[model samples]
Target: MARPVPAGTARADDITAKARIRNAALELFARDGVEGTSLRAVAAAAGVTVGLIVHHYGTKEALREAVELAIVERFADAIASVPLDSRPAGRIAAARDEAVADMLAASPAIVDYLRRALLDGGGEQGDLVSRLSQLSAQQVHDLRAAGVASTNHTVGEQVLTIMVRQFGRLFLQPLVDRISHEFPEDIDPSRTPPRLTVELALDASRADDRD
Candidate 1:
């Protein structure tokens, strides 16, 4: 008969196993999409049994939620890191640039996840929408405190517009790729490059104030 494993050893194994599953799920889902991928496929990619995947995640929906939460947390952390104390307009511009760059670096998987969430219109999409709304409110508050313009549009409206633009850029990678070819480094988020979206948004906001 085999002897029982120590508690610490069992815990470590659990952690490693869960991490493996998550990493594999992320890769497969990124390449194959959420609906296209399967629990068995995820298990195969992770080099584990299907039962193990089920045991950890309980269901495909749970796994999807896990992935979405992880991605959102990374984005939130990235946005939070930007220094907001500078000139409002400049700071917002810088923050948006950095946020995009950070998201790009975090993983292309996030774009895939967003695409599914937007198209599916489920609990996951609702959760992400709510989180984004909160982020937008914070951004508006920061802008107002810094004395940036756009006093006419409510914070919710501005936030929703920005979120929509972000979703468009994220899901429509082909467009971004074509634009990148023309602008070269300017459109590439990896380089924290200048984004036309950011510039246009800021310009529009300022224009609103002017008019």
Candidate 2:
């Protein structure tokens, strides 16, 4: 059970309304996109006046930025919570998948938002991709340090591969489901079958040893 807020001031209500407006905009932007969505539409959906949104966020771009930052933070928080103390590659993969699933369950809109961001090509996509690649590269470095991954593989290429596997798998899920019969959304990332990450790591290790 959650604790109730203390006997309230208008501040709490104002915060709640602001959140509602954002949530409404999030849904609209996720579905219709930023270019397609309007302050009027968001206001209608949120059951608030357009002036209220303007008062809180000032501009649509600001509101969109806020939503994007919130989504990124949520993903970061989820991934950050995964236990990195384990050295086993499989365990690491499982933990990552668990975190992904948990975050998606809580905020399914994130998937739509990310997929659009990639496909539609706007809203800090380049920065987001760069951030994701950097994070993936660091994870690869950690796995290599743990002796569970191949040090021979360049972190750059590994990050690219991971990004494709992660986002491609997400954005093209319907087709993947049809052909591959794998639904990442339905199963935990860890519960799903082992993938190219382990194979690439093993290959790298083998190549290095042969040298």
Candidate 3:
């Protein structure tokens, strides 16, 4: 009873459909672990047919990789905004806070996604590690320029330690309750603000520079 759609119109519709599926998958993958989400679920969430999801992303792993790419791209953009030319510790701290805040505000789902990845050790862990390494190198460069304490440990180590602590307190642990559940004896989230932790770390790093 319905007339056939034109070739151009059908192609455009297909593109729109694919985009919707990808966006919906990103949200689901960010909130729920990839292993927990299925293609039918993604298709239903996106208001598309399961066939469309397969047409756009042939497999669940491909869909997840796309989601990871989007998340990492957004995070990297935020981090790139950090001022590299300023005093090291101050700049690194400010940049870190900005990136965290941006992630919290712009992509709250990503915090959950990151928490899952960090705790479960799944989905682009290598990419996350690489990014942290790069950020740590940046921090070391900043610290040296700012006259903060010089350390014999490699920048990668310093960055990994700082990143793990910061992410654990601010993002990962709070998102999933992993730390609280695993270590009840540890500091509770209600007892301390994350900013205080950052301040303490910043102060310790710059202790020698102070009068």
**TM-score versus the correct structure, for each prediction:** 0.65, 0.65, 0.61
Error of 2 at 34 (Å): 1.0
TM-score of 1: 0.65
Model 3 lDDT tens row, 1-211: 1122222211134457766666666667666678877888888777778888888889988887766666656655666666555456545655555576656555556666776766786335456555555655676676667665256455655665556545655553353455356666675667753232332233465543211
Model 1: lDDT of residue 30: 66
Model 1 C-alpha lDDT per residue in residues 71-181, reported as the tens digit of each score = 666666666666555445645644664576656545655666666666765654357666666766786777677676366766766676667656655656567667668
Task: Pick the lDDT winner.
Answer: 2
Tens-place lDDT digits, model 2, residues 99-141: 7656664665677777777777644534555556667777677
Worst 10 residues of 2 by lDDT: 1-10
Looking at model 3, residue 151 earns an lDDT score of 68
Worst 10 residues of 1 by lDDT: 1-10
Q: Measured by TM-score, how close is model 3 to the native structure?
A: 0.61
Enumerate clash totals for all models, in the order shown.
0, 1, 1
Candidate 1, after superposition: displacement of residue 163 in Å? Answer: 1.2
State the local distance difference test value for candidate 1: 0.63
